[model samples]
Each structure stands twice: as structure tokens, then as C-alpha cells.
Target: MIWQLDLILCLFIIICAIAAINVKDLLGAVIILGAYSFFMCLLWTEMGAVDVAFTEASVGAGVGTVLFIAAVSKTKRRSKD
Candidate 1:
């Protein structure tokens, strides 16, 4: 495993996490979090953890994103701050 590639993916994952947390729009945050999950899945696959990556891709990036979007769509979408 190349440490450089791993570092890059880890950086991207951290960036996505921070962006997801800071984003004002609910949908945008959800999208960013989904992206974060995708990066995490990539890292897992790169590390030879294929099963973990598959689960993360299907559950975190897939169903979790869909569920978050659905919930956000049903909300008032207002933030106190």
C-alpha cells in the first residue's frame, strides 16, 4: 500500500467531513456526508478491506444518503443560527 495515496484519501475524507458539518443547506450537507462515506469506502478498499468497503458504499453512501435526503425534504429546512 502506498502511504501517499492513503494520505490523500484520508485528507479528502477529512475535508468532506468538515464541509458537511459547515454547510448551511441540509441537502448540501447530506451530499457532502455521502461523499465523505464514498472516500472512506475507497480508503477501505485500498487497504484490502473489500467487505468493509462494500458495506460502507451500500449502507453509508447509498441508503444513508437517501434516508437523509428524504428526511430533509420533509422538514421545514430552517436553522436557528
Candidate 2:
């Protein structure tokens, strides 16, 4: 069961990463990146690294997503150059 869950999480992370790169909207890409981070945190937890998972969840999924969205908001949604 644990291995199955880990496999699922890995697959989810991969899908989120692809979505993050392919999404046309900057905000959507940022959101997908956050989802990828969340799956990574889950993978860490499955690997018996609770502390690392907590840190990833807090920094990667939380603070990082906020920063990305803030940076995106500061510029135009679509870049001409």
C-alpha cells in the first residue's frame, strides 16, 4: 500500500510539473507549481522524512507559491518580449 501511494504521488508530481510548464496563464502555472510542491511533500512523508516534508510543505507549497504569485502579479500576465 505504501509503495502504491508513493507511486501515485510521484505520478501526480510529474503531471503537475508538466502542467506548470504548459499552462499559458502565468497564475495557472504558478498554481500548478504549488501543486507539484505539495506532491513532493507527500512523497517526502512517504519516505519517512517527516521534518523534511514539513519544511517542504511550509516553504515549497506555502511561501514559495505566495512569492511566485506576487511576482507574477507585479508584471503583465503575458510578456511581449
Candidate 3:
């Protein structure tokens, strides 16, 4: 059961990563990146790395997302090239 959950989380992380790259809008991509990080944190927890998972969850899902969004907001939403 636990292995199944881990596999699902890994798949979800991959999907989020693909979505982040394929999304047309910068904000949407950043949001998806955050989702990717969240899944990564889940994967870490499932693997029994609680400390690493906590850090990943805090930095990846929290500070990293905020920074990416702020950076995106400072620039144009669409790419010129």
C-alpha cells in the first residue's frame, strides 16, 4: 500500500513537472512548479526522510514558489520569442 502511494506521488510529480514546462502562462507554470515541489516533499516523507521532507516542503512549496511568482510578476506574462 505504501509503495503504491509513493508511486502515485512520483507520477503526480512528473505530471506537474511536464505541466509546468508546457503551460503557456508564466504564472500557471510557477503554480505547477509549486505543485511539483509539493509532490516531491510527499515522496521524501514516504521514503522516511522526514527532515528532508520538511525542508523540501518549506523551501520548495513555500519560499521557492513565492520567489518564482514574484519574479514572474515583475516581468511580462508572455514570452516574446
Candidate 4:
């Protein structure tokens, strides 16, 4: 049962990762990346790595996502293409 849950979380993480990479909009991609990081943090927590999970949540999902949004806000919303 635990292994199954782990597998499911892993699958979600992979899906989020692919979505983040394939997304064309910078803001959307960054948000997807943040979701991916959040999933990773959940997986780490489930695996008993609370410290690592906390760091991933705080640094990867939290601060990193905010930074990306700030950077995106300063640029044009849509690309020239």
C-alpha cells in the first residue's frame, strides 16, 4: 500500500515535470515547475526525509516560484512568436 502511494506520487511528479517543460507560457511553466517541486517535497516527506522535504518546499516551491513570478512580471507577457 505504501509502495503504491509512492508510485502514484512519483507518477504525478513526472507528469508535472513534463508539463512544466512543454508549457510555452513562461508564467504557466513556472507554476507547473512549482507544482512539481511541491510533489517532490511530498514524496520526500512520505519517505521520512522531513528535513529535505522542508527545504524543497521552502526553497524550491516557495521562494523559487515567487522569484520566477517576479521576473516574469517585469517582462512581456506574450512572446513575439
Q: Identify the leading candidate in terms of TM-score.
A: 1
Better of 1 and 4 by lDDT: 1
Tens digits of lDDT, candidate 3, 1-81: 298998899889889988889888889888899889888988998899999999999987999999988998998898532
In terms of TM-score, how similar is model 3 to the real structure?
Answer: 0.92
Clashes (candidate 4): 0
Which scores greater on TM-score, model 1 or model 4? 1
> lDDT per residue, candidate 2, 1-81, as tens digits?
399998899899889988888878888889899889988988998999999999999998999999998999998676432
Residue-level lDDT tens digits of model 4 in 1-81? 289889999999999998887777888888999999999999999999999999999999999999999999998655442
How much does each candidate deviate from the true structure in C-alpha RMSD? 1.1, 1.9, 1.6, 1.9
Q: lDDT by residue for model 1 over 1-81, one digit each (tens)?
A: 789999999999999999988878878888999999999999999999999999999998999999999999999565443
The alpha-carbon lDDT assigned to residue 1 of candidate 2 equals 30
Q: Each candidate: how many clashes?
A: 0, 0, 0, 0
Off by over 4 Å in 1: none
Residue 9 local lDDT, model 4? 100
Give per-residue lDDT, candidate 3, residue 35: 86
Instruction: Estimate every model's Cα lDDT from 0 to 1.
Output: 0.91, 0.88, 0.88, 0.91
Tell me the spans in candidate 2 whose CA falls farther than 4 Å from its real position. 79-81
Instruction: Give the worst 10-residue stretch by lDDT in candidate 3.
Output: 72-81
List of clashing residue pairs for candidate 3:
none
TM-score of each: 0.94, 0.91, 0.92, 0.89
